[model samples]
Target: MPETVGDYLLQRLRDWGVEEVFSYPGDGINGILAAFEKAGNEPRFVQSRHEEMSAFQAVGFAKFTGRVGVCMATSGPGAVHLLNGLYDAKLDHVPVVAIVGQTARSAMGGHYQQEIDLQPLFKDVASEYLVEVNVAEQLPNALDRAFRTAEARRSPTAVIIPADLQEEEYTPPQHAFKHVPSSPPSVARSVVVPPDDEVGRAAEVLNSGEKVAVLVGQGARNAADEVRQLADITGAGVAKALLGKDVLPDDLPYVTGSIGLLGTRPSYELMRDCDTLLIVGSNFPYTQFMPEFGQARAVQIDIDGSLIGMRYPTEVNLVGEAKGTLRALLPLLQRKQDRSWRETIEKNVSDWWDTMEQQAMLEAKPVNPMRVVHELSPRIPEDAIVTADSGSSTNWYARNLRMRGRMRGSLSGTLATMGPAVPYAIGAKFAHPDRPVIALVGDGAMQMNGLAELITIARYRKLWSDPRLVVCVFHNNDLNQVTWELRAMGGSPKFEESQSIPDISYADIARSLGLEAIAVDTPDALGDAWDRVLAADRPAVLDVRCDPEVPPIPPHATFEQMKSTAESVLKGDPNAWHLMLQGAKTKVQEFIPNRR
Candidate 1:
């Protein structure tokens, strides 16, 4: 029996080592679905309730595994649904391959049912590579190329297969088209080292200045030890971009946490006072968080030359992989003997941790969310993978979680989308079955894409490799971040009911899905709930009713923010006092000197 076009595509995906392919079924994709079933689940097809959820899972998989994530969708609306999540992949620089089903080739441009022009639809997001497999014989090669391009560019790629052609028998291309048969091209996996002159120039800029600072991003993830070596040699205080939070151990003496509004006081202070800044593989966008132009001599290193000076003004630019470039530059860097600047920053870091501990332990009626993160931080296994949703919960996560040992993390990051946390944990769990996975999400974000994913977890649950995914949902029943943002931005905090959501019992929903779950309303109950969830040896959800009054504090506040707070308080905002107290608590120590 001859192979069908759909079978060939499935076989190629399996050959490419795709363990699971997320999809939402529709008529246009029936051919591929049939082929998937016929293939005996070699690349298991994981069904999602929505096409968007499928795409989100793909993005999460790519983020956690550092490999190409594959997602499939039906024609028209189903294919259209993937754009939002695919954009997450594009913006975050994760590799993803979207297999979209199209109407029959003959029906295209005729406005038939479920027919839409997919090439133009995906043009912007899948700009790296987007093509239709109009020719049945070219699919094997085109599918291969899509995966290769996605991996090489670390961007999303799309390949549309028309329904009519998908079931057609596979045929070899004619001699005219197949003049040569060659091996599939390999994606380059080696690191590129910068030229000696480039490294020397970067070293010269660093060696000439005192009070050096280093900012790292996801691109520097694998170069943590090298970054530490660079920091040690130059007496630099290291700050991380949020996406690069795990690039260095958070407890390192000279390591300041994140670098922007979601960052730390020590990091902000380091950015303010440094005479020289060394940026590694990060395009941290907040210029306000960096020194003014020419305030510090800046040196940037990245594998992509185009991104070298894109974020900050540069005195020297070295184009190479972070680890390789740092390795080459280490030998050339002049060691700074002065320990005063580094020691000062380290002291501030210590003081900042003390302040954080104080904030985490602050008692609140309905459990302070910070307390949950702080408690979970020490209790989770060192090798666990944690995912956080975008909201006020991210504030607690950014400020609290310690990325030590082999612990890993992922989030919506650049896209900063809500509802990726649960799907991200699902993807991460599938990728590393042996590692424990946890997701931190707020009530709003969880209600968006959370419940449907529990069904997914139950469907795929296994005895030995269950992943034991735990979802910690902060059930605050409000869009707390936006409410605080209104006050912080000087907008009137009136009509806040529009920003609020009805209190929903997410634990009940999780339990209905046949997963172990509990709802905890107090801080003391949260610890025991987590212990039960962790020990249950199955996927679980802990719906924590957190204090809605607590504010997500920034490392520093501007005069405008102060004015806004005063205005909101005067306007009779109910949580105004709580916000004020939390904001002051977060920053008060900055004004006091540490006796130790």
Candidate 2:
């Protein structure tokens, strides 16, 4: 008999090879938290201020390590907050498991504090959901199901455990059985190829084009050789999405850059210049820039047939892995001999790349944080992990951070969420101390989740903390600049432009907590400050001011979107969704008041 559900979960986690899980103590999950503490710090439980922060920190862990980042939260709203970060993981194809505490099993049907319909809430966001009510019978099976599904699909999986059942006395099963691969081979599966003419026609589009390009995505993982073949065959350039970052190295010659708002000019402009696009395994959300006859003429190859033409139109949406598809289509492509078009596109690429270099070296103001990002990239230890928040900071790095040789970074992709980098840095440092951690957070993002809990870790670490956790902040005002852009739809933002906001002084906050703190207002000051901070043997924060008005991927004011805005303009009220976006529960009832 299992005495405590926490004990059962602990044993299960041990069996599944879970090394660490981030969490925050809450009323409903205290018993499980206690049980985890008894692990004698062998598998440490990292703590954060909010459940959302915990989940985001875990997201960072999964991104860098390629393991299932685990997080635990209390029942009700606590469990609900985990959904946002879980959505981030699921969409990014990152493996993660969120074990949320529920109310007492005995009080299952009755009303309970901090209770909500979490099962339904999590179902949509999570890849798989397993609920354990009868701990003795279901806990083992549920744990197995949750972990196996998460790894097989590389998405988020969840388990719900009632708080009371966690404390009930019962012994969980042993961890003696050998762990086998979750996915079993399917003999019923058979591979097929496109019709001969279909392949020939698709190849003809590439062969006939004066300027051809390969737009690779996640589908290019196993098809790297195929993509290389096409690029070599036609002298075509390649570009990748953020999720497809690993598909092509930034320094690769044929690789132009990423497309979209964060996309560099080289990729965006180069792709536009090409008459033909071979989209492989990318449902890139922004299709305005993509040649949309949509993807119809643009030959798209993907294993998942349903993803074809999902976001954009696909002219030749071939349903097969990119490697096999290209192999089948290879016999049809005549050895391309047109060197003039390829040479012209190459010149365009070189020009675009030169412009990007110029932008990197462009003169910046005293508070320009781009200078800091550029300088920091070179100074950080090799194999450094950078985690950045949403807001304007996302734009700063999107434009500046160069990742060719020395440094490496991982961000919360898919469901872009803020308030992640700080806690994420913590978890990242704990998980991999050899690789130094650098977290860039916006002022608004920090204010959302960067309070006492952050300092508490610093308090413990100041004396004995890992020397590699380095935190940098863009102390531009406590402002969500994206909101300002959204508000610009109807009214000119002149009044808000001159709105004076005092610098929040996060450095003072960190210093008060007994960690290294430096405020950098000018690039010169940042130079001196960074030198000292980088040399520190403990956690540190360089709170620097930055331009607040930058956001990557500027919004498109479509005629339809503008027409939608006219209703508000006609009504004389601007949208104030920033309050909700910032997760201000107190203002939820006030921001969008419902009239009786």
Candidate 3:
């Protein structure tokens, strides 16, 4: 029997274990859509209001289930709408398959109403693209490759089936391959321990150095205990990168804080001044803080061999599992009480932590973003998923949030985009209804993509009893913190910096959709607000009107774009000057009484 390309596409999808697909119908995709609907309908299709929403929903599904999220859209504009979600999936390493239907093959380059080159547009975001010309002849190969690429790399891939091709029936050949993919390979790399002398040399340098710090990143997730063990053996303190938040519990005594601009002072200063720094599974970027070649001799331990010397000058590069490396170096490490160095750094780490809490988390009048995140973090179920949008909100949340080892995060690198967390929260909730999902987002970012889905999830999930619940903290501050950072790059100051403005009332927007909503302004109201939302057992939003002047991202926000911020600050404030003084104080205090 022969099958149309559209029909064959659906049959292959069923064989690939796709039980459901979230999508928006289009002219380019009608053939496949109908085929998917008719081929015994093993994988049900849920309709969406918009193509972008379909992509977002697909990403959510993938993030939630650790399976590939699939979506279908028509060519040109419809395919264009998917860029945002596609970028989200790519940046966050969420596996999704965007099956976009393009114009008929004959008019591909004749500028049809909806014809555009998708491969070029998708190359950066998708791991691989299957812009199939012949589904009956090419689908088996395309399907296998698309799914494999998406899963193995934890990235999205696309399969564009033209409208004309979808309607043509051809004798589909038997697929030579039947092996379903299992999972992506762990980034962990195995390496044999070094010779005894190398360990002895590393131990000698580590012990002899008066000041030392252990930096942990997501790389340390698998070797938390070993990292702590090494830290204890050397009497060294520990700090984590934002992604490494839970590598060590918040309660550990030797734990100072994370190191970065969106980080604490004590840990940052101690890290900069330490005589011997040990990087256990941390390929932390921002080498600016990690001074040039010999500021503090650094021992690099990571799963990737190439990453060892790639960032900064490494004194010793140990290529192996962090745990394995530490175990090998354990016997060779020299135990000593370098009281002077440890004390100097400890006082600095301690005082900095206190001051940060005061200035940021425990402020009196206006609410602090940190406190909101801190109060919320402990309250959410320990195992529930956490997704963060990139901005002041994430800096605040990442600095204070901790989800013990084994906790899942929908975080990507600095290519932080908004609207992702909201949809990601949706997908994660769908993925693990057994656990709660918390989405930390700033209004500027969240509004860019999330609100439209308010009505869609309810419509889609009613048939299958939706399990995912989201507590969205929508910070309503219309300010981009990156403007001041622009001034720091040797550019003349704009008298009216544009970082202090407030726009968007997300609470009102959310309430219209029949969901619980809370608006809070003061710090005291935060704890109760979060609690109320969590107890609702349904979709909820905590719209917080925060002080727009909050100083959050710089390393994360280096692009100095400002107009409103300058206007807001010049009219009665000198935030650039004020922040300069505050940042100066934060830096100087590091050398105070216990300043390492």
| Candidate 3 lDDT over residue span 35-150, tens digit each | 87678666877666677767777887886566788887888888999888788777656678888888888887887787889888777787455555554566666677778778
| Residues 239-294 of candidate 1: C-alpha lDDT, one tens digit per residue | 99888887887868998998898888899999999999999989889999998888
Model 1, residue 491: C-alpha shift (Å): 2.8
Q: What is the C-alpha lDDT profile of model 2 across 106-222, one tens digit per residue?
A: 777788678776778887778465565555555776777777677666688888878887787764445546322222211123455666777777887888776777777765666
- Provide the clashing-pair count of each candidate structure: 0, 16, 9
Candidate of highest TM-score: 1
lDDT of 1: 0.86
Candidate 2: worst 10 consecutive residues by lDDT?
Answer: 179-188
Which residue segments of model 1 deviate by more than 4 Å?
A: 177-182, 463-466, 577-596
Q: What's the TM-score of every candidate structure?
A: 0.97, 0.79, 0.79
Question: Deviation in angstroms for 278 in model 2?
Answer: 2.5
* Residue 419, candidate 1: alpha-carbon lDDT: 88
lDDT of each: 0.86, 0.67, 0.67
Regions of model 2 farther than 4 Å from truth: 1-3, 169-209, 217-230, 294-296, 316-346, 357-365, 377-382, 451-453, 456-466, 478-480, 483-491, 494-502, 527-532, 549-596
The 10-residue segment with the lowest total lDDT in model 3? 180-189
As a whole number from 0 to 100, the lDDT of residue 12 in candidate 3 is 72
Model 2 Cα RMSD, Å?
9.2
TM-score of model 1 (CA atoms): 0.97
